[model samples]
Target: MRVLLDHNIPHELRRLFPKDHDVYTAQFLGWEDYEDGELLNAAMDNNFAVLVTMDTSLPYQRNIDSFSLGVVVLDVHPATPDVLTSRMDRLVEACSRAASAREVVTLN
Candidate 1:
């Protein structure tokens, strides 16, 4: 699976995904300035399978149904690397099973 980590997610968290999964960050993709909608569009256009983010408001702020990438929202404030790591198993499982556009998976 190809996972795109939103700008708010710590880049260090990329290391926690399964070894076979390809992970990239918005910052590394030169898309740190992209708004949520724009980032989702780019992820879809790039054929990213899942978009991992810490933005709790994303589901309410945008119509995810319009995008083709699955979204995984981490339910935690200040989603530091350690917090994300603790939730890595669920995140990885969500990524592995992600299919269909607009699929949403929440991990705490």
Candidate 2:
């Protein structure tokens, strides 16, 4: 799956994702300041299968069903690299199976 990590997530987490999948980040894409809707549109346009974000309100703020990309919203309390790393498997699984327009899987 091609996953796009949100700006809130640590860039290093990209390395923890499954080796077979293609993962990119908002920072890497030079879209760190783009609005959620625009970002989602860009992600879908690029054929990104999933979007990982730490923002809890993203699902509620945006009309996800309007798009065609899966989303994983990490809900951990302390979103450190170690904390996120522990749940990489779950995140990966969510990303792989997520095909809905809006899929928000919490990592807490």
Each prediction's whole-model lDDT (CA): 0.85, 0.85
Candidate 1 is scored at a TM of 0.90
* Native RMSD of candidate 1 (Å): 1.6
Candidate 1 lDDT over 8-103, as tens digits, reads 888888987778889999999999999988999999999999998888889899988888889988887556666777878888887765544458
Tens-digit per-residue lDDT, 1-108, candidate 2 = 788998898999999877788989999999899999989999999999889898899989998878888888889978778888888888888776665435666667
- The lDDT of model 1 is 0.85
Give the clashing pairs for model 2. none
Stretches > 4 Å off in candidate 2: 100-102
Instruction: Give per-residue lDDT, candidate 1, residue 17.
Output: 76
Tell me the spans in candidate 1 whose CA falls farther than 4 Å from its real position.
none
Model 1 clashes, total count = 0
